[model samples]
Target: MSERINDIMNEEPKRGRSAFQPLIYAILVVLGVYIGSNFSGNSTFTHRPAASENPNKLVNIINKIDEMYVDSVEKKALIEKAINAMLEDLDPHSYYISSEELASVQEPLQGNFEGIGVEFMIQKDTLVVVSPIQGGPSETAGIRAGDRIVEVDGEHIAGIGLTNSKVMEVLKGEKGTKVDLKIQRRGTDDILDFNITRDRIPIYSVVASTMVEPGVGYIKLTRFAKNSYEEFMMGMAKLDEAGAESIIFDLRGNGGGYLHVAIPMVEEFLEDDKLIVYTEGVNSPRSEYRSQRRGRYADKDVVILINSGSASASEIMAGALQDHDRSITVGRRSFGKGLVQDEIPLPDESALRLTVARYYTPTGRSIQRPYGEEIDYDNDYNDRYDSGELYSEEKIELNDSLKFTTPKGRIVYGGGGITPDVFVPIDTIGASWYFSDLSYAGTIRRYGFDYSDSHRDELSSYSDVESFLKGFKVTNVMMEGLFKAGEEDGYERDERAIAESGEVMKIRLKAHMAKNLFGDEAYYRALLEDDNVYDAALEVARNYKDYAIVDGELTLLSATEVEEAMTTN
Candidate 1:
């Protein structure tokens, strides 16, 4: 039986070993197929590139760095560097505003901010209050003129590298928030501390508006803000109600603001369907602005004033008036800032003020001057001066490439600012080094403030600005004091120069005093008596028929007839 069993086992090829061998082989084949299929599925799904992965072109470089680089590198830092490098190739006006500085940059253009409302200057490492804005928190807090802010919230802020922006950051807060300020007075020894509650401070666009002469109105605009058009209309309406037959719109130091504000302001002076200004750019769509309604002062004799600091929207208004032969432009040439900037917000709550388009006048003249890899702003006004364009009748060199004809067929030049129809040169007659020193040293302002404070009651007795001007005098004693003050500051007083500038000094001192005692209107009314620009404008308006000659032929009729024609035509 044993022999027979051994034979059967041998024939079966050993039950334990041979039976498991085939099973092991089948299991190995099934395991191999499962592993292969799993790997293939992973390659199609789990091995795919991530959503935030870099591009295919950078994959090889990344692999090389990962394999051979000496140090670990962060991808975020490299991405930021690339973005900054890209923005550097754009224009100077195109700028990035960080999230921290976004609100401060937008506040001024928006026309209101929460602050104490005092314009200040840092002189001699001391915080000097220049002027308290009218109807503001500072004024309401009884913050007087010439007060120095020595501390803010018990922290010393006078001379410790405090910047203007830093000071504003400390002072400005939400409306109704109280801020403690320690002030140092010139005449007082005790430090005065006041808890001032911040309010919505209005930055005015119309600086001063008054009836200059019997029938002429004067309005000075400082900036084109959101309320600029409304302010301008109010001034014109007031002037018209005050029996003003002619208007002088002063845009001397106005650095422009919103384009929308400027367009409507232009419409206030132009007739319906008149072209105001246009804009075009390489990547931007062409846009044309026209007056949609009749103007309030369409029939009134108008003169527009411009200077070197008059830029952007100011240039647009002056250029439009000049192109349409609507008003006489006086004073120096304007600042040529024709580019329009659009504020675009970023993902991080920051913003980008990007230059997107270039503005052009109604005559198709571009007001933008050339600027490239290197900007040469030094030749801006000096070139105009050297060419005798400020005071001479000699015509400016009109580049045929830039020439564009106005509606009246008058030739106008582009590639720069609007050249005034009547040029009024800067009055440098009384501008000696001594005068400059006195002006810069704050001697004139200090003396004026002191004088006004001392003689407030006496000065206030006068009925009006004209009466005050006639009665008040900047005496020889005052002049001697001013000269001595100027001399102590290392300025040698030239006797002949002082005598030549005596009238100018007297007028300036009186005007400053008037401003301190009464208001800006009183000051400007006094200063307008000797203004050469105003004199020229008055002359032009007085003889409109002769001055408005196109192609040397009289175009304007009598003033009354012109008004009638304006209404009829």
Candidate 2:
């Protein structure tokens, strides 16, 4: 009976083992099938491996060397070099502003900065103060003309490789900061030290605003800064108060500034809801700016003056007014700069003013001239000159690929600057190499300043411009001194040319002297006594019909009548 029971147990054990083995094998097979399916799925979704390392692997290698190499490398210096290299490939206007150079570069365009305001020039390796800005810290601190800056903040600045930018850096600081400056005056042997508490120096955009003729106002804008619109409005109000019937907005050498300032200035001429300008770009949304109801000179006859340097916002104002037939644009073709640059701030306190959008006129004309692949902006104006477009009447060819018409059906060109209604050729008759050398060598300014100083008492007696003009004389003595100075500087004076240019040179010298002594208004008041362009604009303003014809619109006067009126006027 024991043997039979043991046999049954062994058979039972065998049967249990076989059942468990089969179950385990089935579980293993299922697990293996699941694993295979997951592997196949992952293979289908995964990316392929690269055959070689990335092209920018050198950058990574350099970074590793900078981090863990035995020898130390200046990472900041490398970054500045890289930044300069990057900017070199961009446009000429696109420049890298180092941390130390940012403020001085932006001061003029911003209209104000903290400093002792003085315009200066370098002469004979010495810093010569040209003129102190009116009501500025330098004037307040008793810094006068003919003072030479020898030291700033205890550092010897004279006879060193001190640049204009470096001088600005040393002179300008936050308001309430004191700067110690050592100045050498012309009459004094001992150096004069001035401890000036820097204050906010106002940079003017509107250089002059005066009555050019009876009932005709003139305002010369040097730039469109932050306070430009306000300054312009003030000028207009002053002119209106003086019974000005027409206005001439001069934008001759204005390279332009804030668009916000420009739009409102154009609004002063246009009515409400009139399109001023529009911008478009790939990454930027289309933006359209229209005139609002807050205009001051909406009912006045306006003439805008432009030249080769009048660019960006100036072009916008001129184009908007021309497209709407609100004003007649005079002078030369404007500098084409219809692209919007946005100042993008970086982590290192540096900024990137990248061109983000292209601007268009109300008539849908794009004023952006072609840029080469290498972006040589120096040849831009020269190309215009070479094409004979600046001074010729070769139909003023427009790119048909980008032409548009104004609301009044006037043909407008595109892919270039705002074409003036009346083109004025540059006055180059007296621009001989001798004249250029004298102008460039500071001979004009130096002689003018010296003459003004010697005759200050007598010159100050004439309170009015007309009286002063008649009283002050650029005599033979002054001319002789100027000629001698020019000769000493290796500039040979052309006898006939000098005689021919005498009138213009004398007038400009007197004007510069007046500016240094009195103000910008006085200078312009003296200079405009014989400006041909201003006279032409005044004539246009005197006749509304002539103005309308030039603005590409038919008027009450016929072509014959207009010609007769122009002849008579």
Candidate 3:
């Protein structure tokens, strides 16, 4: 009976052990799988890697070199170089700004920076005040154009090998800071002393605005800075008051600034809810900027001028207007830069302007040209000149795949710059090596400055731009003086070339003189009086029908055709 009981108990225990054996086997299999996935090179299991463990390869390499190097190395410089290299690999616009360069980088976008508020040039190793910024601390303190800053804060600065950067360092300071400047005026015998309270000085975006001709207004927008909209509005109002029926907006040589500033300015022309521009990228979602406010000049005829130097915010504004058929684009193709960069501040006060998204026109045209590792993207404008694209409309090669139709069925090309409706090929009719030498040698500028300085009293007597334009003329004596100056500067005088470019040189000299006397507004007014592009724009404003796009094609009336029409009319 005892043997039977022991046998039954042993069989029950063996049955329980058998049941647990399968569970133990299952646990071992899971442990093996986890171990293999975590350690094995050929593992297929998805185990999350730790954030800290997955260190940057570049950082790791840098650290290794820092710890085990032959000699001491500047870690900061190495890191900066690495950052720049990384950015360069990404895109052309993605760039790193060091701590030292951060302030100047933000100055234009900010519209204002605390400084003495005087435009200076290092002439003869002396800081010469080109002009005190309008309504600025220097201007308020009676600082005049052509005044030489001899001393700053009781320290003699003249003839001390002063550079522009050094001068800026000495003059620019925190707001409400006082700076005592000893000025050497051209006519004054005594060194004039003035105490200027350094304050927030504005950098104007609307460089110039005036009624170009009867019933036409011209506004030269150099950049889309912070106060651009305000400046633009004021300019437009001035034009409106002057009875301007049409507007010619110049964006030539404007290498763009803030996008927020541009969008608002674009909205000034576009109707409410109209798509201005859209941006998208792999990381960035499709975001659209539309006209939010009622446009100020919705019904006004506008002609936008652009060239290869026009980029970024300039392209955005131009593309929006073109896509919507709100304005007529005139000039050569624009600088293709449609990438949107976001300014990201690093911990070290350095900055990374990373290309976050690519922008498109309302017609879904990407204005950015194709870029590759081998391409010299910086010399693209030069390439255009070399390829004869700047001189002829036919040379502007457009891909059929890049074709996009505007709102009015007008076809526009993308994958490059914005093609103007009226393609004004670069006018190189009188451009000669001799004239170029004179211009590049600063002969004209020096002549203008000297002339202005000598006749400051007489030039300052002119109250308005119109008066200056009518009164000022580059005399034969002035031309002779300029040619002599050019000859002195190692530039051989080409009489034939000079004769060919004489009229242009005269106009430019007069413009420079005007710039010295009145301002940039007066300068542009004088310059554009004979500008072919400006004349073309005027013709467009007068008879827009002749240059209008019809059946997805533009009947761009040449200057001769427009002139003939004017004569007939």
Which consecutive 10 residues in model 2 have the weakest lDDT in total?
A: 1-10
How many residue pairs clash in all the candidates, one count each?
0, 0, 0
User: Tens digits of per-residue lDDT for model 3 on 389-463?
Assistant: 998999999999989988778899998889988888788877888888878777787778778877888777788
Reference-based lDDT, each prediction: 0.71, 0.72, 0.79
Q: Which stretches in model 1 have alpha-carbon errors above 4 Å?
A: 1-92, 97-105, 119-131, 141-170, 181-194, 347-350, 373-375, 393-395, 487-497, 552-569
Steric clash pairs (candidate 1): none
Strongest candidate by TM-score: 3
TM-score of each: 0.76, 0.80, 0.86
> What tens digits encode model 2's per-residue C-alpha lDDT throughout 1-569?
00000000000011122323432332332222332333344331133325663424433544564688566757555444444444444533444455665665567667898888888877666787878888898998898876899999899988997788788789888899999999998767898989998899899989888887788899999877778888998999999999987898888778777777788899988888999999888887998999978567888888888877888888888889888888877777777777776654444555545566788899988887666565555566786778776677454666778766677766667787888776666666455667777888888877777777666666778787656766777777778788887887788878987877777777777887887667678788777755766666777777744544434433446688778887888
Off by over 4 Å in 3: 1-60, 487-490, 545-548, 556-569
